[model samples]
Target: MTNADKKILKRLKKEDKKALTELYDSYWEILFLSSYNILKEREVCEEIIQDVFIDLWHNRAKLQIKISLKAYLYACTRYKVFAQIRKQKAIKVELFDDLKKRFQYTNPETKMMDKELVYQIEKTISTLPKKCRIVYKLSRNRQMSHKEIAEKLSISTKTVENHIGNALRVLKKSLGYTFSILFL
Candidate 1:
């Protein structure tokens, strides 16, 4: 850590507004640029940078940064940008999937069957191994895409797909012939 950053962090830990302002002034532009480079959204980048500082201020007393303040700020910006990307991807996927499902099963009986299928799938997911269950929940319940689940859980997309496959195999075995409807 630089001498200046160390001093600033020390004052920040003590709730010094001047230190917080200094930190913001020193890092905000760099952080914003870093995020903008990835997300390419002006307002989103601005909000992300603001969130980084807000988080820093809120957790100032417990800050345990092991890197330089600049690196830490950059890391935070990158993480926020990735999270925003994942959120956007998930929302888009969810919307598209919802539209498809809505059009596919409009009748009352099909709707009831849909509900039961979802319940059975969820029940089966609950019986999976910890990682597999989490992956399945994030993919099915949260409507996150495989890529989003992988990024959020810090795993490979292939790993996410594998986990989903494992969960599905379990579901198929447990639900028997009824599970075959999902493929159709």
Candidate 2:
């Protein structure tokens, strides 16, 4: 770790909120730029930075610093951005498979199964509040980041994030049982 990072770590270890704020201020732009480059969305970049800070603060006591804070934060942001991309790719693949199955079979039994899956997806989505649904759709379908969605929808980035969290929670609850059957 750099001397500056060591100093910040020392202060942070003592539970200094000001040090945490300073750390954030010091690295936010660098982390944002790194995330923006990978995700190509400003809103997502901001959200990634926010999450990094939250994680850092919440897990401060448990964190062991072996690298410069800047390097560590950049690494964290890169991983999160890549993880989000992977999730989007997986969702797209699942949707594509569903579409393929829908087209390949004319048997009534298979058709009914396909219809049920579609209905489940639609039903889970329909349970979301209007804004959450729109946010989820834009993020998943349009591949827009939270920053882009917030800007387009005229809402705060935090609000965009909350909507996404709510949507995911609802989807997870709705699909939790199905996931085990489908995967196993």
Candidate 3:
């Protein structure tokens, strides 16, 4: 979180409407677009974003931002998306395996492409700065909040956020598309 983010958060904790509005304005489109891209359901994505904001405002008093606000909102939106997926009665292991088999057999070309893409992502991650790679891995693989990462590493949250931001920028440039879909 930047100093401005911290100030807004502090104001939000005090139940300031303007702070909430600022947060909502800054993040609404980002939340909507990311959720929509993954879920492919515009109405549900909009609802999810709205629900996230409502929850954020309602729980502002007790909020412990272990991540940047944007990251936190993204996590919340992701959880809601997965929750909706689960609610649709999709068995995780079976559904994933089924999807993989469907893709692998139906399109050998696509399967090869997928493999190459995964390899490229792995290679890119490996080339990141040591601390940036660590931060990225912790956030994506361990699902740790930035605050938790900072605390565990005895660093500031801003450093963790910076590392993540830098890593994402690098990955985005390397991938030539939306890297946030897989990580971030």
Candidate 4:
């Protein structure tokens, strides 16, 4: 945060309403757009951002931020968006029986297709350079965050991101038709 942001934060800690409004006015739109990119639902994204601001107000005095307010806000919004996705996935799983009745498909075919894709994906991964393969496996198999992979590999976060990006590009090229389906 800049000195001006620090001043606003200090005022917010003192429970100043103007500071709260200032923070909200400055951040709301960017935060809303970030959430919308993930959730793709305007109303839900709006509510999530509003909830974040309200939570900020409620815990203003106790807010401990190691990064800038922008980083903090973005991280919070991302987490909430991912949480919402998890909830939606759970609900979808619960509704699977109803959904299955509405569609006609054989599970064995789906399972076979999945297994074939997995085998092809593994083959593609095995062809990557050693560092890229390691980073990709740590990210996809272990479910580690980029920062965690950086820390584990004793590399910078940007390096980790680049490796992951390069790995994805290679996989997309190698898999061709299969790549788009994996992402979807």
Best by lDDT: 3
**What are the runs in model 1 whose C-alpha is more than 4 Å off?**
90-184
lDDT of 3 at 127: 96
1-184: candidate 2 lDDT, tens digit per residue: 6788788878887899999999899878766765565456788778888988887787677566554465456556555765666666745544344433432243443344335544665688898999999999999778799999999999999999999888877765664422312211
- Candidate 4, residues 48-117, lDDT tens digits: the string is 8898788778777766553356555654555576567767774554433432222112234333433445
User: Which tens-of-lDDT digit does each residue in 1-184 have in candidate 3?
Assistant: 5688689979988989999998899878867766665567789889988998888887778665533566556556656766777787854665444433443332444344345555666788899989999999999778799999999999999999999999988876664332243333
lDDT of each: 0.68, 0.68, 0.71, 0.68
Where does candidate 3 stray beyond 4 Å? Answer: 90-184
Candidate 4 collision pairs: none
Candidate 4 off by > 4 Å: 90-141, 144-184
Cα shift from native, residue 176, model 1 (Å): 48
- Poorest 10 consecutive residues by lDDT, candidate 4: 98-107
Q: Indicate the residue-level lDDT of 15 in model 2.
A: 93
Error of 4 at 77 (Å): 0.8
Tens-digit per-residue lDDT, 121-150, candidate 1: 567778899999999889876879999999
TM-score of 4: 0.51
